[model samples]
Target: SMETNKRNYFGISQGLIKFHPKQQYCLTAECIEAAAAVLSKINQSVDPCDNFYRFACDGWIYNNPIPEDMSNYGVYPWLRHNVDLKLKALLEKPISKRQDSEAVQKAKILYASCMNENKIEKADVKPLLSILRHSPFRWPVLESNIGPEGLWSERRFSLVQTLATLRGQYSNSVFIRLYVAADDKVSNRYILKLDQASLSLSSREDYLENTTEAKSYRDTFLQFMVDTAVLLGANASRAESDMKSVLKLEVKIAEIMIPYENRTSEVMYNKMNISELSAMIPQFDWLGYIKKVIDTKLYPELKDIGPSENVIVRVPQYFKDLFRILENERKKSPHFCLNSFRGVFPCGQQESLVSGTFISSKQFYCLLQIHSPLSLV
Candidate 1:
């Protein structure tokens, strides 16, 4: 089974899977089933005690799963996370006054290419225009505004390994407490340690399967999910939209996490802010840690911090500082993005998300500052 599973790497994993891959109708149940089985296997192998994201999926892909509207393989969770930050920043301001940020422009261009029918269309669009028309839902905006693209052209991609399989292929993945002194002295003595059981939950990378029909159904499902939530009496506060937002946020962050397939520890170590995360261990640099955890073949693109370079996402200050370092480390790596479903913003941030904000939620989206926890241990 190990030999067979290892041999099935169809080179399909090399790049993102666009829906219209030359063949207009190349989706097959066999392929989706294969993907599902892989996911099921990975889930099964996941230790119930561990953090699902760590073992269930790789760092980059785990952080950036595919979106639901269409089977977009390119737009990832991290980039989307960046997109979300730009959007949230805009939304925080008066709608009429919201202006385009660099990340917003990048998202629009990237999103347009993934979902647009015509290659030449400008992806830049107003938030209201986007919500009313181009939302993951299939409804036309207002009366006669037809969206520029059809949902049929989306793409999907994922990776799954059963518990039985993962146990055999690799050592269990876990998180451990760390202390990095100014001298760069690494001590495994005190505090937490990396363990496989920490990442036990199985993750679903692509929102849904890659079939054309499945894609359409999913678009409609997500559309209704948002629309229904909108019509049901509620206020449009970020708090109410929490449920869908967090779900979307998790997958978005996973896209970035997945690429460092085996670098869970290194990714966690490099992400300086991750250590500061509410429940996370002290003094961990997740982004750098992830870089170190994965083999060179699956190394992540660590960006560099520079005055001229725009930050991809509005990460916590710790992360903002480390982004440049991560970028520098990943300078030579290829860039891949994932597209996720976008719906009418739900009324308020959902409760589920608020509660779990400390989880994967923080990885992509920003925290509401539930409490003013002072920095450091």
Candidate 2:
């Protein structure tokens, strides 16, 4: 009887241990769902040892087809799309005095302004024309009616001054892009850096290469520029002729530019003061340009920018070649063909101004608050 009781007690203890929550070999619903998601992306038919990428991603590729508008689709773009949706939701949320930070409130206001299509449609091109009527923004191409014989003086059109105005007030990078960045060597102090401006096409190769695709791209770009000029009230025949000249100039620029593969840090990192740079490329006033750009009403303290200031010229050869091209263009067309070219490809507009600069949404919102209060309306 004692032996029987002991056996029964031992059996009861074993059953209790098997039924315990910690001891049970079962997964939660959340874990099972997560596992299902991971498995769905994997193709069991594809051997991992032979082709790991295919084994892991074949099923996913089969499930997600590339959209008609997209050139390609991938995980990064998917993640980016998700992030954009989240950002849109956040930005669209109603501004609450209790919950919103200053930056958030400002962002909400800016987003709201952007979304108000009715206000935008009513305003039309008046706002843009108002901006263009300003001194530096007065496009020479559009100023045919202003000057004697419908010709603006080349003397008044200072390349350095124009570049400064476009870069500083308008945030346009025409040919040379100038910005303050941490010294590559020092990595502590900031110094002005000069780089080749981006082209309409993706690469210099697109302009210089003699291929079917390159020719197609060049033709398309020329047509686009001509159309833009026509839309902006330029004479169609003159616009076509001028845009062709601009395209040729860009091609020359592409020919001189250092290819991406050859542009090593050691090769491109040529540091010099503004005076030395001026001596090297005497066509443009480096010191005056820098001073004008930095000495803004917003930053009154940055008034003493001088020739002695050091700068990093990333593409020295490109600048040398560019100045030569400018000299040739100046000799060929006294009024500066490029000056007229600006009307066809006007900078300082929302689209052109935003390129080549990296700014977070919050930072951009803050900038809008400081510079153009109307942008936040």
Candidate 3:
């Protein structure tokens, strides 16, 4: 009787009313806001069916013009800028709380030191001069007594020793870079690896090419080196002449180096023991240099890295060519300074601060662990 009453109703005659539950809209306020934000970036005028990228990104491209200082701008650079800003803010914060981590405190100190331009300026060349006056870094170009009468002693200038000092102390990789890394073949095990050092210019192509840009780059670099030498007490004329030789030597090195394109994993991966490597390239005392580097007070446990140690020679040909170049250069010039100018350069001080921050933070963590709260209590 109820069903008959419903069927006899006025709307039910035209089948306008149904018993099914009403359909509900699923979108929330937040969902609608997000959709609006996405839609705002799209150019409705440009048909997405014809050119999707232009339709999607036209509004964004119009809004964010590239800066004058930047050659290009992209998502990665924007992300990096945001991250750097966050890091700067974090580092600028003062260490007040007693419970604050030692690592955070050390990072704040390092950042403060870096930011203290007044102190750095006051210290001036003194810090660099101190480093230059030290054993291996006492560059003959910088020394007042270096000339025809008081030439640099070849006996005292051991390439191996100088290289070791640069690599170990300053972390400056000159002609060759030696470091411990995971074995390519056996990813689990760590082994020593040697590779060609980076060039002053961006690439070997910069030196090899005869283009106008290449020539300009090379000339500017030469002039810079000459100026650096002159600033460090070298006679202007002599510095110019000597730096020309160094530049020429670098060009030759560039010629011999394996091009990055050709240096595939298979081509570069040549694993051999230190003894075998020494036999292959006998110009330098590889074992002795490695021993000296590892035997430092910082790493007393690594004193006896010997000939039996396995090493991966990334570029065997580069080493062979490098030794030949070294021999020729050694015979030609008495003073062999490799990137010694870096010590006095103002840029180097800033670079050291930035580069050493991570290392300093790690050292702080180690010290904190050694003197933990339990130990202190």
- How many clashing residue pairs appear in each of the predictions shown? 100, 0, 0
The better-scoring model by TM-score among 2 and 3 is: 3
Ranking by TM-score: 3, 2, 1
Measured by TM-score, the strongest candidate is: 3
266 in model 3: Cα distance from truth in Å?
1.0
Q: Which lDDT tens digits does candidate 2 get at residues 223-276?
A: 767776566666778778877878888888888888889889888789999889
Residue range with the least summed lDDT across 10 consecutive positions in model 3: 350-359
The residue-by-residue lDDT of candidate 3 on 1-377, one tens digit each, is 86556546634543443343573444899988987867777787885556779888887677667643232456675665566567666666778669668867876676677567688789876676666666666667655633343345667667777778766655656788777777888999988889998766656876799987678667767777787667657788888877787788889989999997989999989999999999999988999888766635767667777789888999999999988988887777777545545423544321212111212333333232222222212
Q: Is candidate 1 or candidate 2 better by TM-score?
A: 2
Off by over 4 Å in 2: 1-90, 96-115, 143-151, 339-377
TM-score of 2: 0.66
Clashes of 2: 0
- Compute each candidate's TM-score over C-alphas: 0.20, 0.66, 0.68
Candidate 1 regions off by >4 Å? 1-204, 212-221, 234-254, 264-268, 271-377
